[model samples]
Target: MARALPQPRRASLRRLYDPQSGEELDQALVLWFPGPASATGEDLAELHLHGGRAVVAAIETALGNVKGLRPATAGEFTQRALMNGRIDLTQAEGLGELLSAETEAARRAAVHASEGGIRKKVEQWNDRLLNVSASVEAELDHSDEEDVAAVIGSGLSYRRDCIALAEELERALASPSVERLNEGIRIVLAGPPNSGKSSLINAMTGRDVAIVSAIAGTTRDRIEMAVTRRGYSYILTDTAGLATKTDDPIEAIGIERARQALDAADAILWLGDENPDIASDASIILIHARCDEPERDATPDDRTPVSSKTGAGLSVLWEKIEELASRHIPAESAVFFNERQRRLITEWKNRLEAAAQEEDLLLVGEQLRLARSLCDQITGRAGVEAMLGDIFARFCIGK
Candidate 1:
């Protein structure tokens, strides 16, 4: 009897060689996973073959003959990982975000989430909530024997702490800036003619993305470009100059479009040569254009002087933009960003705040429970299989 060589360990790609030839021939790559360390906590196997119709057909034929082997369905591997406690639902979402992230900020956010930032926060909140619930239960159980005042006082203190935690959560969840940062902030450039709106756009993006001209109303349509500053992506829009008494239909249409852009923008860079004043309902940042020229008599609140031609004060403008973005958006601690998370968090916050205001202990307990359940949904601990499927289905199959 001839001794057999030990089988090579399987991997993402493997090679099978002809036994007799000892020369280069057909190959089959194998993938194998042992239990516990595997994503599914079970044995797994895969086969890869050389690129050729005949080779693939041979491998498939061999695999079909094997018992208990089947093609993996989309998300089956990730779903198994979830079921086996290898990863949580938030991690799954993070994976999707990681795949789709087009900017550095978005990628960082996804990496933070995948590293358990969101899950850790949710767990902390849940732990606090559980403690509060236990204390409430204790008070309710011993209501008769203890001094009623003492029991009530202790319950009140616990309620206050719980209410404070809920308020903090609400603030975090209410942050729209974090979502905007991840999704790309919309910054609209608006000013009167010859205010350097186009120049500023070019300077910020480090490219001639817009047409710059000495004449007024050169830009009659809205132009958008993606600008990355400090690892954040901003969808910067340079709209036609906003001015009065334009009879041209195209100019009128451009003005209307500018107004619409301002309304939808997260921030406005209002350029001005004389006064730095531009009226708008949007959050405005006053920028004194033509800073290369000598300082003229002008008084504008929080005005930043910028010279796009020489790059003067551009750094300050970028910093100001970052500051405004941070102020409007949530930090990394925010638990809600998308519509689903926002709706759930808002509903829970409303109920919890109402209970905190009420004197009824039973109602307070119920409200706290509801709030915990909502947090549970964020962490996927509340049995959200259907929602998980929908969320993961949006991702590519490999993830």
Candidate 2:
């Protein structure tokens, strides 16, 4: 510990010493932030010590020996900040994203969110909803009074405002989800046995992640490889060849999983001669594989002919894949919601829509109140005790 608390909010040169042993531990820079304005909204101290494992260990030992001193657990500081209203759930989520962000785009987006991008938008929605709720309350309380009735005007305006807010939030959902950005776009490569699906995936990713073989049903499961290209992220999935009649149980399971992958795919490269019977809304690109062979060089009207052996037409395939992915890639400044936030916001939007449609003032008021409570949950102001453990668990210690 320092001999004296460093000048408030300023870093000061200090000699750290072991409290019990009275031995100088290190010469370091220390900072002091007095209560109510610190990062955690509590009195805080910062130690800037030399980059040495022994130094940190000694300091830890010293602090451990002190009464009432203990190491902060994972996300403890950030949780304290949230509890004290220094930051909300969204910002805390953003900080977690920032810490784990692997790509430049993800980092930039996380930075924006961590700096209150989503919070500002939510605050605006809250204010507008509050105004609408107030108007509804005024009408319900004073419908008998002539002047108040005139000002309220049959409550059409507030209803319209509620509808408009709902529509706005609906549009906001069009932005790319945080999960998509974090997990990368799901791109599945699928086709009949020995249709060069494995070769193509290995070529696309420049890594031999799948076994290349002439034998049928070699791939008995999905092989996934994460790829980042042109500042966009993609998960290239090579699935077991879809055989019409397979007796092996493992191959059958693989084929079934391939179909499931198609269901979840953002885009599919169907490397088969015949058109695939895909039911999902995923973008399916018919692929003419082994185009380097003279007989298979003729590409159909919509099919992209690619030969992984010679790396022929791979760039074109990438262009098409990138084009499909670009539609879901959000702008850096755009607001993004994770799965939980999106669900809550969707519920809030639905509540607002219900308020807009309801004829009964009491029901409308109830809907508006529920909408407000959803906003509270989104911001971690209420009803998030069950979620705290899981959320903070994502964060590293002392964040």
Candidate 3:
């Protein structure tokens, strides 16, 4: 009627069996963790078993038969950890961010949060604002009505401090570093009809991601591929060749899509050395297609002439493109990798700005409180119940 408790931390050989049939399921290493040191600040056990379907299914079936033992729900263990105060909301959000990270830059940013990068900064801001609030509160509590000018002076000093913090937040949120890291750098291939835009993307990716053809409008749809070059992720898009007039409706739609892609691009590979007059701050690398073709200038001073057929200038092109991608990746900044974090940060910044401008000390303190609440939301504290269902639901069972 009793089970032996396995040694803590060290894995012990154990055999799992089906209770109904008394059949040995499989041998696995069972490790037991007890008490406050455990991840959830409670007793936890881990069963290290072979991966795959049949083995896992057998073990799961056996576990279900045991009295008073059941399977964990999605994110249950992590949720337990959260409830136990083992990790804060920022770290919990970071865990979610790390789970969904698709790129190296994104993974690194998420790691920063999980390692308390965000919490540290938020706590620092919290301290500063609390100190400011306390200063204002102290003046309000003071009995001396004679020194009215002194209170105004103290208020002015507090306003200056708030202004400084607001500007700092402004600069941090102004740069789209988080968005760039999360979305990856978009590099679009755009050019005139039969200008080898598709061919260039295929060559750049070193894969047949796009169809290359001599026909003017063969590529009637946009093809996109995410590629990692030099430890950086880039989204390479091959669009239908731009043409002033097209009789085919599909081709016209593709061309319009191409324009949209270019507009959204972080960097554009303008094939055939022609500017399409698109308004974008994105880097435009004029690429001259078919350098090996006859009746083409081999040396264009402004454009990078590349022959996809011969693999000319591709190496240099990648280096140039990576340089552009790196510009989007910032160093030493508090990055918000998801839309939720971005929105919360934006709200925090706006509230801080409003707090600085409020004439009444009580209103200014309230604004700071509201701003801190926004920061709290970003890190997963207040206003979390509304989002927990959606966020934790994404995690698989036993997480």
Candidate 1, residues 209-240, lDDT tens digits: the string is 99999999999999999876666678999999
**Candidate 2 lDDT (Cα, whole model)?**
0.89
| Whole-model Cα lDDT of every candidate shown, in order | 0.73, 0.89, 0.79
Ranking by TM-score: 2, 3, 1
- Model 2, 1-399: lDDT tens digits are 435676899989888889999999999999999879899999999999998999999999999999999999999999999899999999999998898887666887788889999888899999999989998999899989999988888566877999899999999887777767878889999889999999999999898999999998899999999998877899999999989998899999999999999999999999989889778889888898998998886778888888899998999999998888778775454788888899999999999988888999999999999999999998888999899889889889989
Which structure among the candidates has the greatest lDDT? 2
| Model 3 per-residue lDDT tens digits across residues 1-399 | 226988798899888778888888888899999978899999998989888789999989888888989999988888888778788777777787788777777787778887888788877877887777777676666626558547655564678878888777776676665446756789998888888888888887788887777778888888999887555778889988888888899999998898899889989888855566778888898887788888775667888878888998888888888777667775334565466776777787788788778898889878888877887786667778777778778777778
Q: Estimate each model's TM-score.
A: 0.79, 0.91, 0.88
Better of 1 and 2 by TM-score: 2
Tell me the deviation in Å of residue 259 in model 2.
1.8
Worst 10 residues of 1 by lDDT: 1-10
**TM-score, candidate number 3:** 0.88
Query: Pick by TM-score: which candidate is best?
Result: 2
Better of 2 and 3 by TM-score: 2
**How high is the lDDT of residue 112 in model 1?**
77
Model 2: lDDT of residue 132: 93
